[model samples]
Target: MSGEREPVSREESSTVAAVQEEAEAVALVPELLISDLLRYGVLLSLSLVTLGTLVTFLRHPDYLVSSEALQRLTAPHPVPHGLRDVVVGAMAARGQSFVMAGLLVMMAVPVMRVGLSLLIFRQQRDTVYVAITTAVLALLGLSFLLGAAE
Candidate 1:
């Protein structure tokens, strides 16, 4: 044998290319999912805040019908709050509550991205990314816990 390989057929080459394309698409699933999640999250957050603003302005010609309420909303010093507070306020259908909830959703998106990444990496058997994403997610959780303590 002169080390010459067999002549490649066009059909065979196309089949191989198709398989490779399929694999590439499969690999992209995680990325696509994450991107879609982030996009939707931002949209949802924006809509919530917009709705809250409209509701507040309409309900209280001057935003909650009081300058104090507006000041509280725009205060430089963020009032330390909890999920329970947000939930309760939102349940009351208050504009401020919806705005706060929207902000909370915005803050949560990145954490959720990391978590979703870890899950996808694990599912795809990518050990390195899984470990890295897991650590990131853990750090995020720790920070939230520490922040709540303050």
Candidate 2:
């Protein structure tokens, strides 16, 4: 035989098969990790929020009245015509809009986290994902503080 060995057939190409499987396995790891993190984070966050909201309600249960309840209480069974406008106006201002907005953002933080997590998954980037995750958590906490103040 010549100094050079005989060329291998396609079936003998182990490097290509190993590389292909490694690539797929590598792609799967981050996606699985992200999904797990999001699920756990959401559960933990919701639990904490539920506890805090309950504690707050316990501390000041009077603020739990719905707008309709407030209206009904302010008016008799057959509300007086003149009083209807006043009741409506009062109901309109029942909740603090700014606080509500803050609360809404708080509620959306986990959702935003999911989106950012997916972005990270697609881009295979870590720095931005970690930074954004921290920011979302911080903002969510701030919103909770603002909401709790009301």
All candidates: TM-score: 0.76, 0.32
- Best candidate per lDDT, number? 1
For candidate 2, the 10 contiguous residues with the lowest summed lDDT are: 94-103
lDDT of 2: 0.57
Off by over 4 Å in 1: 1-21, 64-80
Query: Which residue pairs of candidate 2 clash?
Result: none
Flag clash pairs in model 1. Answer: none
Tens digit of per-residue lDDT, candidate 2, span 1-150: 443343453445767898999999888876686677667666665655565455545655675865665775567674222334434533554322223333444566566656667566446656766677666667767775776577
Across 51-123, the per-residue lDDT of candidate 1 in tens digits comes to 9888778777865457787666687876529899888888888887898888989999999999898889899
Error of 1 at 12 (Å): 10
Predicted model with the maximum TM-score: 1
lDDT, candidate 1, at 89: 82
Q: Would you list the C-alpha lDDT of every candidate in the order shown?
A: 0.86, 0.57
Model 1 Cα displacement at 62 (Å)? 3.2
Supply candidate 2's per-residue lDDT for 61: 62
